[model samples]
Each structure stands twice: as structure tokens, then as C-alpha cells.
Target: MTSGTSPQANAAAIVGAARRAASEGAAMLFTPEMCGLLDRDRGRATANIVAEADNPVLAAARDVARELGLWIDLGSLAILRDDGKWANRGFVIDAGGEIAARYDKIHMFDVDLATGETWRESAAYTPGDHVVTVETPLGRLGLAICYDVRFPALFEELGRLRCDAMRIPAAFTVPTGKAHWHLMQRTRAVEASAWVISAAQGGRHEDGRETYGHSTVIDPWGDVVLDMGEGSGLGFAMIDPARTAEVRAQLPSLANKREIPRSAS
Candidate 1:
């Protein structure tokens, strides 16, 4: 879902999407980054959105998780904190309406693209210090945001944690996404030997940002099981634990890694 820079409206849209996913028999629902607000006006956007725990949208998401008896993964949000810094956080709401786990995005996108696009997330948000993996009904799940997808070490850690699946929620720029989105996503899945469920913000937003849509779910074999092309709607696919196990057993690359030197002297 493409979120405008409105907190209330975006929260409502998330709740609505959760209800729809539940109605469709999805055991879990996932949304994209900036699920709350994406405003170019930094001050207004920060003021309108929740940058901390126990905010309205988090509460509403927990309630939806309870009502639907399904897991809800709300993509990264700008969490306002008293420390005067924002955290790029993701939530994993268990079926019982409890926040089972949370993960802050570790990698910050501090790039100056040649296409006249630039972003310095570190200016407004503090980077998370650790990699997090959460246990779920399906399997251990790794959490990551947009720019984090480019780092293979993060996925390596998740693989070490025995994660069977990973969620990469992104609001990718049109240029980058069109060039490397599918290739990178499929590569991560194959490397980790885990199913990848990527929910993305498609289309242009009020912030004048165009996200490359085509939210996809890839099987452990690195095959696209479902792809919601450049549009706004629900995409669905079944994630079987058996498939993950089968793929790992067939090709155990994770167990065959060689330790590398930490640095050059």
C-alpha cells in the first residue's frame, strides 16, 4: 500500500488491509515500509506520526491481530522517541494480539544517487545495533527494511539463527528497483535457503516518491510463487515449512561456508 503522509488515514488503511487479508484466509499479513506516513516535510511528518511504542497505530495493529487470529507484520515506521531520535522499527504482532517481537532496521540508506535522488536516513533515524530474528508459527523469521536487502551479512546472520523465512518490506526508488529488485530478492532467498515474502509500497506517493511495485513471494527454490505487479491490491501465496526443509536438505550451502579473515593487516 502506498501511504500518504497522514498518520490516521494510513493507520486506518492498514487495519482495513489486515481485515481483508484475514478474510482471505491468510495466516499472516505483511505491509510495506513507511506504513504510517511518508512526508517530505520532516517536521510535520514527524509530528503527525508515531515514533515510539504504544502509539495509536501499534495499538490498532495489535487489536487487528487479536480479532483476526493472524500474525500481522507492519513494516517499518518512524518511531518518535524522547531521546530526539527516530527508529525505523518493524512489528510482529502474534495471533493473540501481543507484540511478539520488534526489529529496528540495521542498515541506513545514506546515498546520493546520480538520478538526482538522495536520502540520508541516518540524519533522522538512529541505526539499530543488532540483527534480530523472531520465532513464529511458520518458522524463525528475519526482519529487514528497504536498504538492508543489499547487505548479505544480515541474511547470513539470519541463516545462522536458522530462519526459515524473511520479510523485506520496501519503498524502493523506481530506478534501483527496476534494475535490481527481483535479482537481489531472489539471490537472498537462494543464499539463505529461505522463503522470501516481500511486501512493497507500489506507485507514487504524496511525497513525490515513486516506489517500484511488484511485491513478491518467492519459494525456497528461488522461484516466484506470487507477484503483485505495479498496482495496488492484495497478493497471496502459501509458505510451506516442508519446502524450506527440502531445499536446505537438497543443497546445504549454509553449512559449507568457510570462515574468512576479519580484516587485512
Candidate 2:
């Protein structure tokens, strides 16, 4: 369950999805990254979005979570802060509609592709310094966003922290997603021995930018439990915490890890 449009619309869609999933006996609902505004023109996109702290959209989501009695993983929002800048922030809203925790995206997408896909997120947004993991009935959950999936060390750190699951909400470009999406995701799951729930933004937007939408949920054994493909729809999977324990017990890779020094330029 994710969105790639206006904040209000995204918020409404999330509430609807949450209600529907709850009716079907779902305990939690997760969303996609940048679940608010999407503008091809970066300048204009920043202008149209809201601040995370007092956003009407987030408020609505909180209300819905409270009313539905389900946990809501509000995907990353473009939050305009008082410092005249924005942050890519994710929120975990409890069943009671209270904010359980917040995780800001630490890895900024700063790439220059041969396909003319150039992005320097750090130019416009600040990076988060802290790693965030939250406790839930399911297990300890680590939080991440789009480009963060490229870094395996993050997942390993979460594994070291004893996290059972990780969430990656993305709006990946078609070219990149096709080349490395599944491989990267599965690799992370295998290395960390944790389940991954990745909700993605799919289809071309009104702004003319295309997203590679293959919302996937992978198990600890590196198997894709569900894949939503390149379309607009909901994908669901039941995650068993025992699977993580089983996998880790079978192959304890974490205990054999060693730190090595690197040369500095």
C-alpha cells in the first residue's frame, strides 16, 4: 500500500487501505516512500509539500490509525522544516494513533547515470545520522528507504542490533530497478536473515517521471513471498519471526564477522 501524488490524496488512500486490510484481519499496513507530492520539477515539488511535524496529511493518517486499531508505517514524507530545508522522514504510528518512533533517511541518492538520470538529493535535503529500530508485537523492526537498500552494511548493523525485519519503501527508477532491485533486496535478506517488506511507487506520474513498481515482501530464506509487479495494487504476506531464528540458528554468520581497517585517501 503506497502512493505517489498529493499529500491529501495519499493520506486518504492510506486510510482506505488500512481500513480494508483491517477488515481482512491485517495487523499492520506499510506504505511507500515520498507518499506525498511528486513533481518532475524539483523546485516546485518542494514548494507544494508540507512539514512533517504539523502536516495535515500525517494528522489524517494518525487519526485513521487510531480509528482502525492497526499499526501504520507511514512511508517517507517530504517534510519542510523551520530551517528552510526538507527531510525525508518515516513514521511508525501505533494502533492508538500515537507516534511510536521516527526514522529519517540517512542515505541520500547522489548519482550521475549514463542514462542521464542525475540526482543529488543531498543538495536539497539533509541526511539523518542515527539508525532507528522499533519494537513491535511482530519483532524488532529496522527502518530504511529507497537508496538505502544499496548499502548492505546498514542491514548487517540492524542484524547486529537483533532486528527481525526491515522495511524499504522506494520510488526507484525503471532502469535501476530492473537491473538491481531484486538482487539487492534478496541479498540483504540472506545476509541479515531478516524478512523485508518493500512497498514501491509504480507507473508514470503526472510529472512525466516513471517509477519501477515491484512491491515485494521477501522471507528470511531469500524467497519472495509476494510481488505486486509494475502496477497499482496491494501486496500482502504473513511474516513469521521464527523463520529468522531458524535461519540464524542454522548459519550463524554474524558471530564470524570481523572488522578490518581501510586505507584513507
Candidate 3:
């Protein structure tokens, strides 16, 4: 979604997307990261973004999930923290509108780009320390945010845990997204031998931030199932467990993996 600045506007967008998903018989609907507000305006973000307890956008999304009878993966919401930091958090909402699983993003995107694109997420957000995987109707879904996609070990461990799919919610900058987004997604899917669902924020946001908008889903075979091109929209893909099984059987990379002990050398 084009999250812009208003939480209400974002919530309204989710409702509309949910309706469309329901009509098209999509059992699940996923939103992008920081679904509430994507403001680089520090003061505006501080004033608008509230704690999860006080976030109406989240509450409204829950209501929409229940109302539409759709399992909703709320990609992530950047909420205010007591330490005056941001909590980039994710949630899997059941069809009943109840939160089934919650995950805080572990990897922080603190970078200094030569293109004058600097982001100091750790300055404004407290990073999560643990990996999170949860059971879902589709399969065991591992949760991660944008920057977390770069960590191969995370996907390796999730494969060890037998996670069937990985959910990534991101708001990627255009330059980096064009360069690395699809590559990372395809690579991760092949590495983990798991389905990958990457919901992304596309186009320009209200805070003058331009995000790479191709939200994509990859099967265990590393085939792109759905790619919502550079735009503000949503799409559906059929996820099959048997396909994952078939790919694993043909490749068997996960089963063949042997970790070497460093100190033994």
C-alpha cells in the first residue's frame, strides 16, 4: 500500500484490499511494513505513532480481518516505545480478528549510503533479539522484516526448524530494491527451500520516501508466483505444500547440509 502519512488512510487501504482479497477468494491478506505511517518527518511520526495498545490502525485492521473472515498478516507496524524508540513489529491475525502470533523485527537497517540515502533505524528503533516462527493454515510461517532478508543464517535456521514459508514485509528504497530485492527473494527461497511471501510498500510515500514496489511471492522451486509491479496494489498466489515437498525431494539440499565445527580445525 501507499501508506503515506495518515494511519487512517492506511487502515482504509487495508480494508479495501481485504475486501478485494475476500472477493477474489484469497484466504490471506498481507500488508507492508510500517503500515500505519511511513513518515520521515520525525515530529509527525512521533506525534502520530502510538504504542500498540493505543494504535487504532492495528485495532481497525483486526476488525477488518474479523469482518472479512480473512487471515491477515499485518506485515509490521512501527509503534512508539517507552524508551522513545520504534518497535517494528509484525502480527498474524486469525480470521476471528485475534492476534495469533507476534514478532518484532530483529535486524536493524542502519546504513550510510553514498547516494545520500542514510538510514539510522537503530537510533529510533530497538531491535528484537529472537527469531520467531508460528503455525499457520498454510504452514509454519517464519517472520522477518526488510533488512532481515540479507541474513542467510536466519533462513537456514528457519529451514532447520521446518518452517514451510517465510513472510517478509518491507519498505525498500528504489535504488537498493532494484538492485537486490528480487535477487534476495529468489536466493532465500532456493536456500531455505520454502515458500517466500514478500509484501512491500511501493512508490512514493507521504514523507518523500520512494520505495521499490514489486511485492513478490516465490515458491520452493524459486519460481516467482506473483509479482505486483511498481504500483499500489495487491495480488494472490496459490501456495501448495506438496510443491515444497516435491522441490525438497528433487533438491534435498536442506537434508544434505552438514555444518562444520570451526574449533575442530
Candidate 4:
């Protein structure tokens, strides 16, 4: 859905997306990273962000989920932590408005691009140590956020958990999005032998930042089933549960894995 700097505007976008999903008979509403707010200005971001206890976005999501009976993957929000940093967190809400799981982004997107772009996500967000997985009518969902996608071992660990789907919600940079976004999703889906649902932030933001927006959905066969281009919109695709088993049987990489101990020097 559309993500600007305004929380109200972003909430409006969420409503629009939910309406679209409801009209289309979609079972879930997956949103982008910082779907509530994406601001570069520290003062404005800090002012707009709130603790989860007082977050209107989360409350609205619960109400919408209850009303529409739609599961929501509220990507990541810049939540104010007690340490003066915001937690890059993702939440999965069930159709009944109950939270199924929450995951703080483990891998921070701290980097300096060759094109002069730079970010220090770790400076403002604490990393998570636990891998979160939860079950719903959909399947076992292994939750993760933006920068975590760069680490293949995370997906492999999820594979070990027998997760039927993996969620990698992101606000990726333009360069990285163009270079590795699609390939990353495909590779993960194939390697994990599971569905990968990625909802991404697209276009220029209210804060003058551009994100590589191509919200992608993939199948176990390593095929991109849906790729919503660089725009502010929603796309839906059905996940065939049986396909996961079929793919695993076909490849059986997860089964073939053997742990190698450290060599004694």
C-alpha cells in the first residue's frame, strides 16, 4: 500500500489496501516496512513514532482485522524503544484481532552504498536474537524484516522449522532492490522449499528517500508468482499448501543437509 511520511496518510493507505483486499476476497493484508511512517528527519520521525502501547496504527489494524476477518502482516514500524531507539518490528494478527506473533528485525540495515547513500539502522534499533514462527489457518509463518533477507541461513533455519511460508517485509534501497530483490526471493523460496511473501515500500517517500519497490510473491518452485512493480498498490496470489510437500520431495535439499563439525587444527 501507499507509504508516505504521514501516519494518518499511511493509515488511509492501509484502509484503501484493506478495502481492495476485501473486495478481491483476499484472505490477508500484507503491508510494507515502516508502513506507518517512513521519515528521515530524526525530529519528525521521533515525534511521529510512539510506543506500541499507544500506537494508533496497531489499534487500527486490530479493528480492521476484526471487522474484515482478514489476517494482517503489519510489516515493520519504527516503534519507540525504552533505550531511545526504535524497534524495527513486525506483527502478525489473526482474523479475530489476536496477535499470533511478533518479530523484531534481527539484522540491521547499516551500510554505506557506493552511490553515496548511507543508513545506520542499528544505531536506532536493537537487534532480535530469537527466530519467531507461528501457525495460522494459512500455515506456519516464519517472520523476518528487511535486512534479514540478506542472510540465507535465516531462511534455511526456517526451513528446518518446517515453515510453510516466509515473510520478508522491507523498505529496501533502490540499488539493492534492482540488483537482488527478485533473485533473493526466488532463491529463498527454492532453497527453503516454501512460499515467500514479500511486501515492499515503493517510490520516493515524503522524506526524499527512494525505495526499491517491487512487492514480490513466490512459490516453492522458485517462480515469481506476483511482482507488484515500483508503485503504491496491492497484489494477491494463492498459496497451494500441497505444493510445499511436492517441492520438498522433488528436491529434498533440506533432507540432504549434513552438519559439518569444526575441524581440529
- C-alpha RMSD by candidate, in order: 1.5, 1.9, 1.3, 1.2
Q: lDDT of all the models against the reference?
A: 0.86, 0.83, 0.90, 0.87
TM-score of 1: 0.95
CA deviation > 4 Å runs, candidate 4: 82-84
Q: Write the per-residue lDDT of candidate 2 for residues 1-265, one digit (tens) a residue.
A: 3355576777788778888888988888888888766665776676566676668668988898899899988778888867877888888889999989888899999998879988888987888888899987568899999999998778888988877889999989889999999998898888888898888888888778788989999988899998999967766789888888898888888767778789796
- Clashes counted in candidate 3 amount to 0
lDDT of 3 by residue, 1-265 (tens): 8788888888889888999999999989989988878888877788787887888788988898899899999999988777867789998999999999888899999988768999988877888888889888788999999999999888888989888999999999888898999999999999999999999999877788899999999999899999999878878899999999999999999999999778964
- How many clashes (backbone N, Cα, C below 3 Å) per candidate? 3, 0, 0, 0
Judging by lDDT, tell me the better candidate of 2 and 4: 4
**lDDT score, candidate 4, position 213:** 91
> Which one wins by TM-score: 1 or 2?
1
lDDT of 1 by residue, 1-265 (tens): 8888877788898899899889988899898987877776787776765545647778888888998898999887888766877888898999999988888889999998879998888888888888888888778899998899999999988888878999999988888999999998999999999999899989888888888988999888899998898956787899998999899999998888778879977
Evaluated against the true structure, the overall lDDT of model 3 is: 0.90
Error of 1 at 154 (Å): 0.7
Candidate 1, residue 141: the lDDT equals: 92
Q: Candidate 2, 208: how far from true, in Å?
A: 1.0
Best by lDDT: 3
Candidate 3 off by > 4 Å: 82-84, 263-265
